[model samples]
Target: MSSATGPEEPDFPAATAARLDGLGLLDTAVTTCRACPRLVAWREEAARVRRRAYRDWDYWARPVPGFGPPDAPLALVGLAPAAHGANRTGRMFTGDPAGDVLYAALHAVGLASRPTSVHRGDGLELHGVRITAPVHCAPPENRPTPAERDTCRPWLARELTLLQPALRAVVVLGGFGWQALLPVLRDAGWELPRPQPVFGHGAEVTLRHTEPGRELHLLGCYHPSRRNTFTGRLTPAMLRAVLARGAGLAGVPCRWRPGTPDT
Candidate 1:
């Protein structure tokens, strides 16, 4: 609950994220971040200039917080919040089409309590899995500049550090998250390969942590964006399989359903 400018006022995100001791405090600080002016404006503008379908709903225009348990064994990393989705729900990936598919896949892999995430208070839950993003705010055109990404990375790094004790696996969605997360992993104690790993759907890489006998399984999967899903690049089964692998590596049990994908 502490920060450079005290608990009530958080200055730089990197400084703030570096000092925060727990995920709850980190989430609170993330929501109050206005460090990125462009993102702050865009998120608020989307809230004020409402989408017709969501006109009656109050939008959570601030930076969205990562969702799920504090002691998760597996973590799912995403690029950023969809402008109309997480930007409106206050929780990462909630109220979005991608979330619908992502949560469903998690449910199939026994990582989520439900197949849908409609809002922050939808009563849905995750089991041994935490979902987060590189950027907390919704970026314009769904693209965050490299500078913005860098500015936001301390949060992710800090989150991963907090989860490191229990974390055994990480599933990164899309190339952006893959690229953003590598440096964080290296800085957090995992040894990066000689050549940086290239991202691809279903790509899997095992990393050795500085601590003896500590290992991490990193998996890549296509983002469940409409383009990927509609083009069959990332199907229900494809997404489910990668999630299952990530969870399996964490030694978390999966309650298999009739057609759950296995990696």
Candidate 2:
């Protein structure tokens, strides 16, 4: 099922893209990602080395991608997968400490099912939130090359377009994802704030498009990586605050209660 080709010209018709109000576009995008072969091969190799970590677990053979309600008003954009996390579990923000921090925050903010993320078969799901990484593949040392990031940018663009109806705000998880988003916004002719918005927990801005001033909210936060979480650089409360702020910008009231679906 592995194909060594780049993303095809998206057959996403305007009408089809328009109809994706509540589709599972994240799952589809993950299953269809064909960005870079180097990352793909590295992910596969990581899987082999980490087989003991997932001995009784199911691993996604291809690049692990994002998953959640496609038409959700809030979209969580994370950095690339960790070699042992999404790369092994085949689900964004799963199978790692970072996933734990993120899932816990989403759960607290009325987006996810629970505070803990497990294997692919764990049955947990996002109700009104979608999770995606700037780079699809887990880069070495968790850092993606510039070319790889550029190649992956179009995928995020198509995702945003397809999720128009419910896409209210984009929560960027790290500096890399935030920087990657700039080019996309520029391509869409959206105006950026002066000096650029700095990355911090709960820092957000609304971007205006020229034609009729249509807008999308942009928010920033530190990455929910193991390094960040374990070092206390990011906490569950901090992450929750970021989501709550983004929810406010989107005009989506977060009924942040355990197990309460946001949809």
Candidate 3:
């Protein structure tokens, strides 16, 4: 469960462990992954250079793992880590504006313990929800190429499989995450529609379970990036609505409202 201590070449041990190990072991392996050459170089470079504001800080500078309870019923899929965000803080959607919007909405809907996530040890907790990404390493300019996405797919696929027992709904953030997640879900034995469901804010699709007891739902939401939030393309109310819907689909009650007191 230790972080990568130095720059290393992309290796297969981590990937193998992700498929064979349990949640805790898988996450530890994920942090040490160096599967993509470009991603490995970029994430390490960013850490070494350091941002002006965070010059005094030490960056995690490794692949970021999914964060939250192992048996979470609700899951969230984000595109990738922000260069100075998760790539620095070692936690998904932390230390960034995008996280600010997302965690706040989750908190308002009674999913997250706090509305703000500054770092890993900030005491923020997610109730029945886990946050993950297609690409663990932060790519340059906040974008991972198609090859990189495909290379990183196994980790997510394994993660979903491990979560299948209790996972009922997944909220994918942005079109990238939506596209990236669908195939993984299908590969994990969920029966996706032939035409495939399109991605859009508030878009929802229910896939039949391979085991035939209950279905799994896929929910979409616009990424809570600063671009969308600052431009009015996405509002707190909008994000909260989508999350509330997902919670309901998962059979989880969301008692917190727009003006409800924080838990």
Candidate 4:
């Protein structure tokens, strides 16, 4: 399969992602990937040299995987693991301020079993929702390059492919995640809106799958990152509203109601 110069790019990640059949298998593949040299080195280094507050902690130091049921009807798209967050706790959106805000909102709306996501095996549960990211590793300054996003996209594409049967609503956090996920959705047989919908908080769009009459609703929300939440730009109320809307669209039960306290 190789000429003297080899192919333009080795698509091992994409090829392997396509062969995965289940979320468990996908997790295995994602956590083991070293497809991006820069990411591999960065994630490992962060884990090796942890922050002072977590010096006593052992870091996962590898590519993190999506969390929640394979049959979830709603999915939350994030950017990637925070160095001291998922990288430290081995769970997406865990062990960080971002996780704190997100889990609290999910709990307020009855989408999560607990208000906190401390670590894996903490008895926390998600109802009808799975949370994933475009990239899995911790990038420097919490920003991954374009090349890294593209290299890691196969995992997200495969996840969408596997979840499409049960998935009804997607809640994307931040513009970067929105940008990353549209192509994956398109690849999973959904026709995106012409001109491509731009990302914004409170933005909503519907995508139609190739099968006639099949539809998936998408809602955009600000990333529950510290920058957004700390600045009060993305309040708990704002988060709960978008989450509740997504849950309602996905047919997931919730206790929250519009115009009531956000909880």
TM-score for all models, in order of appearance: 0.94, 0.83, 0.92, 0.94
Error of 2 at 121 (Å): 3.7
Give the least accurate 10-residue stretch of model 4, judged by summed lDDT: 1-10
- In the order shown, the candidates' Cα RMSDs to the true structure are 2.7, 4.9, 3.4, 2.9
Q: Using alpha carbons, what is the TM-score of model 3?
A: 0.92
Q: Which residue pairs overlap in candidate 1's backbone?
A: none
- Clashing residue pairs for model 3: 10-34
Candidate 1 lDDT over 68-178, as tens digits, reads: 899999999999998889999878888888988898888878888888888899899899999999998999999999988988898899999888689999999999999
lDDT of 3 by residue, 1-263 (tens): 22342224333533364556578877887887777889888988988999899898899999999998888899999999999999999999998999999998898898988888988887888999999999999999988999889877878888888886899899999999999998888877789897999999989898996776879989999999999999999998889988988988887779755555545
lDDT of 4: 0.89
User: Model 1 compared with the native: what TM-score?
Assistant: 0.94
lDDT of 2: 0.72
The lDDT, on a scale of 0 to 1, for candidate 1 is 0.88
* Rank order (by lDDT, best first): 4, 1, 3, 2
Show pairs that collide, candidate 2. none
Highest lDDT, which number? 4
lDDT by residue for model 2 (124-235), tens:
8887677887677888888788988876766676677666767779999988888988877777677887888777666778888776748889999998877888888887
Report the number of backbone clashes for model 3: 1
Query: Which candidate do you rate higher for lDDT, 2 or 3?
Result: 3
Per-residue lDDT for 55-85 in model 4, tens only?
9988988889999989999999999999889
